[model samples]
Target chain A: MGLRRIDVCGLPPPEPLERVVEALTTLESDDALVVVIHREPVLLYSLLARHRFHWETTLRDDGVFEVRIERRP
Target chain B: MTPGPGLSLTQAPPLSVPFRFYLGAPLFALLAALLLVVQGPDALASRWMPEALAVTHLFALGFVTQVMVGSLMQMLPVVAGAPVPRPQLVAALVHVPLALGALLLPTFFLTHWPWTLYAAIGTLGFSLAVFLFAITTSLLRASAGFPTVGGMWLATVSLGFAAGLGLLLAPMHAGLVSVVVGVRHLHPVWGLAGWVGLLVVGVSFQVVPMFQLTPPYPRVVLRFFVPVLFATLIVGSLLDTSPMEPYVWSLLGGEFFAFAALTTYLQQRRRRKTRDPSLGFWRTALLSLAVCSLLGVFRPFVGLGNTARVDTALVILFLMGFAGSLNLGMLLKIVPFLCWFHLQATFLGRGPVPHMGMFLGDRAGRRLLRVHQTALFLLAVSLLWAPAHRLAWSAVAVDAVWLGTLLVLATLRYRRAVRALAAAST
Candidate 1:
């Protein structure tokens, strides 16, 4: 089954930390999901850890990073 | 007031507006509101049971104060033309006692514990310190022209008086004083009308026009509201009711003028073609304010038993209907805008990342507005005949569901926006 698509545009400067965790928890996808983020993924990784969202990040450029997560169905 | 050094508009904005930290407070306040919704009707039905104090404090300190402090922090900058000193520290310091005190105060009141009283004293002192700092900073940076800022000045003064009175009344239940000094009586007035009411009125002056795309309320009305209400509250406290009637009348008249201004503004709104949840909220707030004005006239006739019910209704109308709806409506506009604003700040003119509207789907928000409307409608009905405790609780449950839905939608939109920015960067 294809994963549900969602966007994370226009969040305030504080970044949507509580939100990223919430999305990961609710999405519940076994299929690989692609998440793109601006800037470095360091802050986002820590936030994910704080909220207990296990995932992997791959840096493609200074302003672009990709996160992939797979949920057990 | 002296236009002190560093008087530039860009440098010296009001300190009352702490947009970010204050935003966090509402989440906790909403949790507290949920608890009160579960507990309120049952406690009320029991007819002044000992537990009523606990429930009242839950809403008062937990929900109301939470929102109030956060809002103060956020608005101080906008209203006073100055930012608060060490805002992060202030938030951390206040949050501990405020949250803990709300929980402990009720338990102490019910059990009559001395330690809890000591704890209460500590918390109140901490809050007093915070407010004093906020007030001082606000006065130092305040500029001319904003009536809302003037209202805030009055609110700060009233808070000091209210806090002092509250401290005195703490000894009443312990029989330290001969007569029951009526400090607790002023608690609601200071809290409800003085602080929250004044601030909301002040904000509505700015928000209503901007959001609805209407003209500002008349300058005369704006100038009169603060002075008239402050005089009424002060004179009424010092003198007997006979002399204070005119001031009270003035206060009510001010509120009516505000309501009328809102109605007039709504009539001329550029967005008149829409039936959004925000519009539903506007109607609810206007209607509630009108009812509250009528209640003010009948307040003298209300007996002790009827007074509690009537007062509770008024509180529900003002706090939930007026403050609550305004909060929801503003969030609808703010959250999405913030999301988009942050994402696009760096790329101002370079690329084609959409405006704030592009980040938040207005159509999707419009659909969610229906859910909010439904929840609010059920909430109003539940308040009227809160027959069983569970019924009120269920209303809260529905409201939580609505909140959850909004949270989900906000997150999805936020993620999509980030991805879009990332794609453009690459």
Candidate 2:
């Protein structure tokens, strides 16, 4: 599956966390998800680890956070 | 790279520490409401009345301060990355005595009893000292440099001063230090502004954006606001019954305007589309601040003939409208959220955790909110027109019971869910 991008910027905390969760659940083995948020979702990293998924976070120049996720192979 | 184990869910104090205080607050509020019912408009007469003194200490020390202290204990570890040492010891020492002092100090004021006054001075003074030292040291060790930390720091300072001043003033009733002991304005001002207002504003910096999906508060305000407010409070306290009263008013006027303006702007920018009771409560508080600050600043110019009436209006607006509404609003959010957090963390892999919303449930929370709103409206009206006084007192009594019940039920629901999970696991 192609990558899915979920925008959680400007949304409050649990919303960003929830939107990323929903997006992650919808992705297939080969699919990937990208989350755009205002702050680093430090807790999300642990959550992904719990689900045995992998994520890489990159800080954009604009100060927004972008987290990429996919199932671990 | 492997995902790092950043912090455990257990980083915050065991839910019991905060929960004990949270559960205790409504009980105190209930006591205050019952006291109101007993005294009626007589207590509402003026700031100088014994009834007024009793009610103020009950609400300030017993309810609002308890919640603030409890929340700080919870947040210091999790939010600020500093955990108070020997938290259970801290709780026992702080909570029990505070509750005792709330009852005794107010009794002393109402009854003019020397024993009660002395007991209040002893209990409240000791509890507050322990609270300040434990909290401040823990904060000093805190690694995180969040704005909330600064607020807490100054709040502790304010609390120390307020408590000291309170202890000093206690003797006046006992005929110990005899001269009018006019630091009365300074005492409550520091108590309300330094302790209550600072903590509220400080916690808002973190909570408002996260819980409500609002933008971060301005950096300048976060960095400079609390310190300046603390300074002004100290100066005002020292200038008690002085000619510099006008300058003090100016100092406070500027501060309130800035706070109200920032709070209003940030609230308006909140991303939520639907209505929220917390927001309604906050709006009530902010409006009270805005209107009252204006009135306060120009009181010298505009002759509001009845000092007692004006003082009563300001107290209700500040204590009930601002502090009380904000206290309830935050408690509603924090209680359910803490339940959800603890449950989810506990049962992450073991079993199905209960739905977070099921703890308080939306309908119940909304109903509770309605009760508070109605009570607040009646109380505000009672101040304007004397006839509504009994109605206001009765409504507040109901409101207190209503809030306590909702919170207790929420806690029960949380415990039940956890028990069910354990049953399924085994």
Candidate 3:
């Protein structure tokens, strides 16, 4: 599977959200998108679910959130 | 690999719920400007003048409180993970009485009509009761941790105290009450320091880091500052008749000074290097707060002879310079963000959505900021030279109208985008 990563750390609200949503539009069925962000995007999960995507989030050691998102099988 | 909490985006109320309050706020500001223009220097001559009282309430109740309530309605669910029940209904019940009371109370202040005072008190009392109940319930249920939730709790309790004091004093101010109460001074203290100050501090904890790309507020501040500030206000109010009152004000001043200094330092170290008009507004607000803090701490000791003008200047600096600037700056970010957020949600995966810039450009925001600064400058001048009151009023009128127009234009853009999205879907 292809992996695409985007770092949205230090970016303000809605910009991070916008970048992730934009990346999702181009995401292939076989690919996973890894997003690195400053904080837990609590509002984004519902949007991802609505668009038939499943995401797993982990708090990295460096204090950033790493989210892996892909289409639900 | 854990999923985030199941905080539903659906909890965010409809755009109209907050927009109505946002859009409605500037009209009261315009009314305040008109009152100033008509009364000229007399309106601002003294804190106890009826005209001054009218104008203060116009800004405090009509503009500041209105926007604050709307923001809480939106933020509680989205930021704190607590949903307010029946948001539209609650908004309606709150907004109508609030707007009515804001208008009637100011009119009563100007006219001294006994019935208007009673009616104002009744409507405002009802509105505050509903708001406090709803917000208090939401805060209790909020899953968010300290600084935000805890701060909100203190602020809401403060509002209850402020509103309670105002209701008790309204009749006394109008000569409707026979008993003389010495706690008349506590009302504004609770309203300004307690309700307004605490809420601003609490909201800034989330907003500055999220929007301005600043580091989060210091942990010590997040944990103790709000609670300490609230306690200080309580102590100061209780000791209004005691010699310790001045020391309390000095302590409160020091706390605010610390907050302002920390925020300024954080902004200087902000990760985002891009030019932002909101930063200018915030800087102006912080500077004003610092100045006000110094004045508060020193005035008692130095003994400024003309207390009336100094008090009026302090009021203008706090209400207009600090609170007003912060409100304007936040609206610049929030209105566009909300518009884009809602539109994106509606058009999910349907097509590319318009970015926030399309809704309200940075240029427009900067232009409004310039006008706001000019108005502020004119207000400062008007304090020194009485004739400048006319110019100040004019600038204020333009500032209010310009802000209202920009917000309306942003809404219009949102509507056009919605129409386009619907057409594409069909």
Candidate 4:
């Protein structure tokens, strides 16, 4: 499986949302996108579900949120 | 991984829920400005003047509270993940009476109409009761551990006290209840410092870092500051008739000063390095807050005999300078963002979506900021120079019109974008 990583740690709202949405458009069926962000992207979860993607969010020791996203089987 | 708490994007209220309040707020501001223009210097001459009270409520209830209620409805769901129950119905219940009460209360003040006062009491009482209940329920339900949530809790409590005290005072003024001198002073304190101040602090803790890309406020400050301030307000209110009043004012002033200083420091450290007009508004707001804090701390020692002019100056600085400036700045960011956000949701990748900047450009924001600053400056000058009142009133009127026009234009632009998206989708 291919892997893409995007860091949106400091970008404002909707920008982070926009970038993630854009990345998903180019995401392959077998690819996973990893996003590093400043806060838990609560709003992104519903969008991911709507688009048939599954995500796992982890809070790093450094207080950043990392969301791993992939297409649902 | 633990699931995010207190936030559900799906629960976000319909855009109209907040927009109506936003649109309504500017009209009240315009009305206040017009009243000032009509009443001239006499209206501003004393805080006790009926015209002054009318204008104050127009801004306080009509503009400030109107915007705040709408914002809380929007923010509670998004930030706290606790959506207001039956948002559309609650919003209507809150908004209609609030708008009515805001108008009626001011009318009562201006005309001394018994019916207007009684009607205002009923409407405002009902409106605030509903709002406080709805917001308090949502806050209790929110599972978020964010410091902002705690701030919201305290601020809501403060609103209860402020609204309750205000309701009591209105009846007392009409000889329905015996006047309590301490209650008279406590009402504005609870409203401005407790309700308005705490909410501003809380919202800033989230937005400053989120929007400006600044470092988050120190965790210690975030956790302790709001609650401590709330406690101080309670203590100060109780001690209003005591010799300790000056000390309490000094402490309160210090707290506000620290917040203003901290915010300014964070903004200076913001990573964006871009020319943001919102920054100008924020800076002006912080500066006003800082100045007010200093005045509070030093007034007793400086022996600036509490003249009507001095009292008016402090009120203007707090109301127009600090709260008004901050509100305008936030509106500039929020309106465009909401327009963009809703449009994006509607389009759902079927077509191109307009950027936030397109709805309200930076140039327009900067122009409005300049006019607002001019108005603030003229307002200050008018207090000292009697003849400058005309110029000040004109500036305020222009500022009000400019703000209202900008918001309307932004909404119109949002509609156009929505139409374009629909056409493309079809």
Candidate 5:
């Protein structure tokens, strides 16, 4: 399984959301996308679930938000 | 394929539900300014004047509270991950009674019509009870530890206390029961400092970062300060009822100062590379908050001028300057963001989608913020020179109209964009 990572920490809002959506569309079934952001993308959680992407998010002690997503079977 | 049971966090209410409330809020602001225009300087003379009561409630119930209801409905599911059941029905039910009651109560205050007051009580009370119960139930079901979520709980409790006191006052106003004059202070104390204040603080924790591109508030402050603020308000309320307190007011003043200072610090530390129109509103608001807190410190000692005038000025500073400015700032950001978001959701991968930055005209936003600042400046002048009150109200009316026009334009553009994308899709 390949792990793809994207860091959107310094990017503006819609950019981060757009990049993640793009990544999801092109991602392979075995691959998981890891998104590192400066703050929690609260809106994305709903969108991901609606699109049937199982995801996990945790805020690191370093104060960055990390979200992992993969297509659900 | 439909996902069952656990998809509650993913449920987004129809955008129309929140948009309806947003649209109502500006119209209420228009009503408030026009009411002030009709009432003239008398509205600014004493907080007890019938016109004063009307205008105050109009802003509190109709505008400020209206926006809060809409924002909470939008945020509860998306931000807190707690979905309201039948959000559209709930919005419809609350909006009707709340709007009508807000209008009628002020009219009753001005006219002293018993039936009007009674109807106002019924509708306003029902809406508050339903709203509080609905929101609180959903918030409680969410699992814990987000400071934003915790702030909502405290603010909700404060709303209950504030609403109860406000309702009880109606009977006293109607001569049904004798009420304590000192206890009357509890209504605004919990309502403004408790309900409005905590809610703002809670939302700020999330918003400053998202919209302002600020860093997260210090974790310790987030975890502890909101509850601390709640404790101070509760104690302050208790002391108002007690005769033996020497420092009750001062203690509350201290907490407010700390809050104001912390918020100012947060604003200063924001990392956004470009300046936005909303920042002007926010900076003015933070400055007003800091000034209000300092004024509170010396208010008891200032051996001041007319008591009624002083009280009115405090209200203006706290409500319009601090709270209202922040509300407008968020509206500028959120309204455009939502318009873009809902329209974007309908976009099929056909034509190039419009950028979020273009959703709201930057020049138009800057102009409205200028109008708002002009209104605030005029209000401050009105506080000092009574003759300027009419001009202040006019400025406010213009500001409201400007904002309403912008919101309407954006909504239209959003609709047109959605239709174009739909046609292109097939």
Candidate 6:
């Protein structure tokens, strides 16, 4: 499945997180998401785990971190 | 400032000169490589024209090696999810000293200036220290399950050894070492093949796929090439110090396998929709490599008639064709992307931002590509059948023009990107 890109800033943390999960679950989309996170968001790992997402993270040379998450089957 | 929806502040901002340095470095190296071809076989012999040594060092130390160092500082983290330690400081310290050392090394050797040699050694030493720290820090931070990452680590270690070997020999110009066997023979091979060659191959394994958007290299090619090259280099170096025919075989075997791996990867590339200019560069390079390899095999039989010509050809092929061509092809892609990527990131969500395609500036690139191709053609022809001095000098003239034009275009593009970012910031 093709990937989608989403940003995690400005919005309240869990709101965007929950919205991502609910949108994916409702549509049952198999698409993956590439998320851009600035600094380490508090409880971000648990929130992802609670939503049962699989993710890989990269910390770029420029100090920004990108986290890729794929929807569960 | 509202970042356009597709853009984000989180995108990694590209460093201007580091990126420009990476591009500019290779262009300068290409200029030097072409000059060597025009200057003929005397360039390689230890007789050492001040100009020739300056140009050679320009490519080896200033251009080729400099590009690799700058590129790794930027790329290693992106590929390996690692952070370079004190990266700005590393870049800030290394670039100027290395350039100055490269500038002075030729003068020192030419004038037989003791102080200049000392200065060269000191500056080169400082640059090497920065390189070592950059490589070590990046490796330590890398979460290395990746083969490319492993290859880079090996290359970095090899580079350290090569630099040390060069330092050990530098004092020999004054006959201080008492080490009779010419270390010069080992220096180029160690620096070019062992250090620069390994790094290029390792990065190409990732970049060819990433940029061309092609499939992964064949499993066997990736898995075996690195180990085989490593084994051969070790065994061959040992043999250089001993009396072993088996080590010679090992080295040749390793080189042949490298050729095979490169060929396989290029053949399988999927970006075959049209006649790519990059392919033209690569084809010349590959042909050069093949010729150089064969010359190595026939070194003992180079006959007095062919000795000068063959030696000249080998150096030209390796330096200009293999290293220079690959650098040109990759830089064309890298420079544009850095421009588009950084520009787009700033305007993310706020307004319309141009796509990568829009930012490519094909008209400008085409002019540079044409000049580059003309220079390459003239150089190859000059190497092949140039019985006339005029023809050879013409090749150098064309190459110098090419470098000057490239530097201008790259500078303009860099300025454009910076302006775009500044405008967005305000």
Computed on alpha carbons, the lDDT of every model, listed in order, comes to 0.57, 0.77, 0.86, 0.85, 0.79, 0.60
lDDT value for model 4: 0.85
Those runs of model 5 whose alpha carbons end farther than 4 Å from true positions after fitting are A1-5, A10-15, A22-34, A38-40, A49-73, B1-6, B144-146, B241-246, B348-351
- Per-residue lDDT tens digits for candidate 5, residues B159-263, read 999999998898888878887776577787788878888888887787677766767788888888888888877777766756533256556666677777777
On TM-score, the candidate that comes out on top is 3
Clashing pairs in 4: B6-B80, B6-B81, B7-B81
Off by over 4 Å in 2: A1-10, A16-73, B1-10
- Say which docking band candidate 3 falls in: medium
TM-score of each: 0.69, 0.87, 0.94, 0.94, 0.91, 0.75
**Model 4 chain B: worst 10 consecutive residues (lDDT sum):** B2-11
Please state the error at residue B80 of candidate 4 in Å.
2.5
Q: TM-score of model 1 relative to the true fold?
A: 0.69
Q: Grade the docking of candidate 6.
A: incorrect
Clashes of 2: 1
| Chain B TM-scores of the candidates | 0.78, 0.94, 0.96, 0.96, 0.94, 0.83
Q: What DockQ does each candidate score versus the true complex, computed on alpha carbons?
A: 0.02, 0.22, 0.50, 0.40, 0.26, 0.05
Candidate 3, DockQ score (0 to 1):
0.50
Worst 10 residues of 5 chain A by lDDT: A42-51
For model 6, the superposed segments whose C-alpha errors exceed 4 Å read A1-73, B1-13, B23-52, B241-250, B253-265, B268-275, B301-309, B354-360, B363-367, B384-397, B400-404, B417-426
lDDT by residue (B120-148, candidate 1, tens digit) is: 86786686667667666756676534566
